[model samples]
Target: MSKLRNGFIVLLAVFGFAFGSLSSVSTEAQPVRTAEAATTAQQITKINSTLSAKNKAAKKWIAMRESGRSYTAKNGNCYGRYQLLRSYLHYNYTKVNQEKTANKYVAGRYGSWTKAKSFWLSHHWY
Candidate 1:
């Protein structure tokens, strides 16, 4: 009876250790690509010329121009997560400029609750 109890305890301990090691290995092996990082990388690329002649910068600028205070447009339009506003449409001459400006603005408004609301009104994703 004593031997059986000791064996069962050893089995449970080994199982626990195995599972813990397996979980750690899996987590370490799995590349974690955040939705934001992936989306930004994918969306920031320029579209094909057949689709639109605009470069990545141009598209970003247009998105910013169209979006308003909440980084949303007049009609159900949301550009980037940053919620760039339409008021800044002509603010920058290039898309890269627009992105830079947006980065700065978002960083400044990081903790504001109104950030999402201002961008959510039209529910437009540009």
Candidate 2:
């Protein structure tokens, strides 16, 4: 009985409890929704106001292809406006986080959004 109790405790530790039961330990995986619509022009203009001419154009072009500038877009393991890998966003899907994370990712991976756009154009993925 003590061995079984210990094993159950380990299981609980491995999978956190919510409402006294495993919240994320479902038997089936939930499907991720595909992108439905592009972000509104007002939102794009607002975000673009923070960038330079070339960068703004590149960013918008990349976003149009990747996730239509929609912060909620998800394709497979990628998520958010830039379609960054899920691990990169850490499941935080707020617009601010998405923007920050995309800039950071682009900076690290391709040095700038313009370069990323160029790469995306060449390979059809970036």
lDDT score, candidate 2, position 116: 92
Return the TM-score for candidate 2, rounded to 2 decimals: 0.60
Per-residue lDDT of model 2, residues 12-89, tens digit only: 876664634544444223322212123444454565577788987898888889988888888999998889888888
| Model 2 local distance difference test score | 0.78
Candidate 1, residue 54: the lDDT equals: 31
Global Cα lDDT for candidate 1: 0.48
Best by lDDT: 2
Where model 2 places Cα greater than 4 Å from the true spot, the runs are: 1-50
**Model 1, span 17-79: residue lDDT tens:** 999999999887665556655665555353122223333334344345455323323343324
Give the whole-model CA lDDT for all candidates, comma-separated: 0.48, 0.78
Clashes of each: 13, 0
